[model samples]
Target: RHPGWPARLGPLLVPVGRVALRPPRLLDGGAWSHVRTRDRAHLERWEPTSTVDWADRNTVLAWPGQWGALRGMARRGQALPFVITVDDELAGQVTIGNIVRGALRSAWIGYWVAGDRVRGGVASVAVALATDHAFNVAGLHRLEATVRPENAPSLRVLQKLGFREEGLFRRYLDVDGAWRDHLCFAITTEDAPEGLVARLIGSGRAQRP
Candidate 1:
């Protein structure tokens, strides 16, 4: 079950077993280090922090504590932070930051796969799973994700997951060093009539996963 501040939610999730979700653990540090090292180059253009960001002795040491706190908030669904696992190994992280509820329940989805796992289809799987949770478990109507204009891989994943290109957000994020432009993508519960990935691919915008 998702661990968070609130005890429970009435609806918003379904059991997608096999690639089950779990709380992040201390043992993840070693996995994280490996991913960090592998993804440093691939992520250089899109991510704000780089190899230098983690290579520093100090920052690497502090990440666990900060990550733990954030992870906790995510598990409870108070915040949406999930570490993807394939065969019980840490593959990447997906987080729904800046959640806003009430009449309009929405959050922004952000994710990055470990360099080692880039082409294995994990990103699409994880995004779909998270999107399902956001709609069914979190009771959210909208799920949005953004990617750098040049990041074709990420764009493919979002499109594959049934997220539509809503628009382009210029200078949306500060990555590596400079502010970057991004293509905005979104998926509402209504858009996933044939399932997230299926609908996206069926609509002729995304590749089949």
Candidate 2:
């Protein structure tokens, strides 16, 4: 977790057309449960459940002490978190978490597209929106993602979004009980094509709401 990250990150409302990227809400309990189990296998490798795994919906259940600690850190500009949803259904989660400002106007982008939704290219379009939201809405300038070298699906998502392969970082994130090597990828505001959303969806991948 890097420090001083909030100043560099911002907010994004789901763009008008791609309705799947709507903001998740606390009352979405039934749907959230559905996605948790649906995406369980996909997420476990990237991020383990912490005491705060359900923090987005149940803030009160968070360890009061830990909540206060994180709130203080947030108040002081340390990090930001967001939940991702698809067409009013909980399909995944995306976070521009671990922000680092100043010279590093960057944040680590992490996401998962539900197993049932894979191959539909839901993530490809959603990610472009997320990155644009981070830059256009959040006012951040750079976004990066890391994936296990074996994760071809995720890598494809990055490629589809025009993220350049940067390099590999060995033993990066702990997955399913072991640390794994990851290939890094990124897309900057400058590298993105204008009207990328239309292009991605128009390719006949994203099903409009």
TM-score, each model?
Answer: 0.78, 0.71
- Residues 145-165 of candidate 1: C-alpha lDDT, one tens digit per residue: 888888888888876665789
* Model 2 residue 108 CA deviation in Å: 1.0
- Model 2 local distance difference test score: 0.61
Taken over the whole model, the C-alpha lDDT of each candidate is 0.66, 0.61
lDDT of 1: 0.66
Worst 10 residues of 1 by lDDT: 8-17
lDDT of 1 at 127: 74
Against the correct fold, how does model 2 do in TM-score?
Answer: 0.71
lDDT (Cα, tens digit) per residue for candidate 2, span 4-55: 2333211222332233454344455555556655565666656643443443
Clashes of each: 7, 2
Candidate 1's C-alpha runs over 4 A off are 1-20, 49-52, 57-60, 75-78, 197-209
